[model samples]
Target: MTESDDIRSTLIDMLEELDDRLARITDDVKHTQEPLAKDSEEQAIPVENDEVLDYLGNSTRTETDQVNRAIAKLEQGHYENCEACGEHIAKERLEIVPFARLCVRCAEKSEE
Candidate 1:
């Protein structure tokens, strides 16, 4: 297959995986909070579990958003360019984070 076609397939697979993981996280959060789902207080939830679930939920949501943006960029033919500086994003960075929107230099500058 062509490179563009391959990349498109990769993006689709990534999106599907993200969606699956997010759904699992949502279900876990719901299951864990089931005891208090209606203010019954019939059962106590563990503090550590709550914290873990909260963190997972937030990270999953953020990752999902990032993947969506990446898909959009891929569709628009701008996935290789940094969002902030229009520079080409490094291949290494893209390999590590396929959803990255900024080049390493621009990302560092933005952090400051």
Candidate 2:
């Protein structure tokens, strides 16, 4: 398959994995699979766990959105162009981060 096709496939897979993780996190936070602890003291653990799970779910959702955007860019024939500078993003960078929207320089600047 072509490189863009490969990247698109990888992004789709990543999106699916993120979606599954978010679903599990949501279910865990809601106590869908297991009931809360009966003991008041024991309840603290699950509550703390739920907080962490919520954070993970949020991050996962963000990544899912990025992947979806990348897929859209690929469809539009603009996946290789950095959103910030309109420069071509490196092939190696794209291989490593299929959802990347910025090239290395722009990405570094944004982080600063």
Candidate 3:
């Protein structure tokens, strides 16, 4: 009903989607190095198994950390405020990046 609830619900939905995709990546990593029989086709995947595993692990960690930070911001009553300037974050920007920590102006300045 309220704007905060809407944002929270949206973020939860996004996090759930990320979790599902991360689970699939985990499965892929688990099966990437399946033992091949002597007669089985010796096919090398385009990416190295170790590299894929590392990449998947890092990606999952990053996503989880971002989700956690968003949840933390909500709990701390800072969800709609920019961390850098303490200004209210624009709804448009928040809709696009629910985990954003800065407003457009501050974000642009920081990038410079």
Indicate which candidate wins on lDDT. 2
Q: Write the per-residue lDDT of candidate 2 for residues 1-112, one digit (tens) a residue.
A: 9987788889989988998898888887777337756765666677678778878988998999999999999999999999999999998998888889999999999999
* lDDT for 12 (candidate 1): 78
Off by over 4 Å in 2: 32-40
Per residue, candidate 3 scores C-alpha lDDT tens digits across 1-112 of: 9877887788788788878878887887777667667666555652576687778778877877887788889988988889998999998998888898899999999999
Using Cα atoms with residue i matched to residue i, what is each candidate's TM-score against the true structure? 0.79, 0.88, 0.79
What are the lDDT figures for the candidates, one per model? Answer: 0.82, 0.88, 0.81
lDDT of 1 at 63: 82
- Give the per-residue lDDT of model 1 (tens digit) for 7-58: 6787778878878887887788777765564565544555677788789878
What 10-residue stretch in candidate 3 is worst by lDDT?
A: 38-47
lDDT-best of 2 and 3: 2
Worst 10 residues of 2 by lDDT: 32-41
* Candidates sorted on lDDT, descending: 2, 1, 3
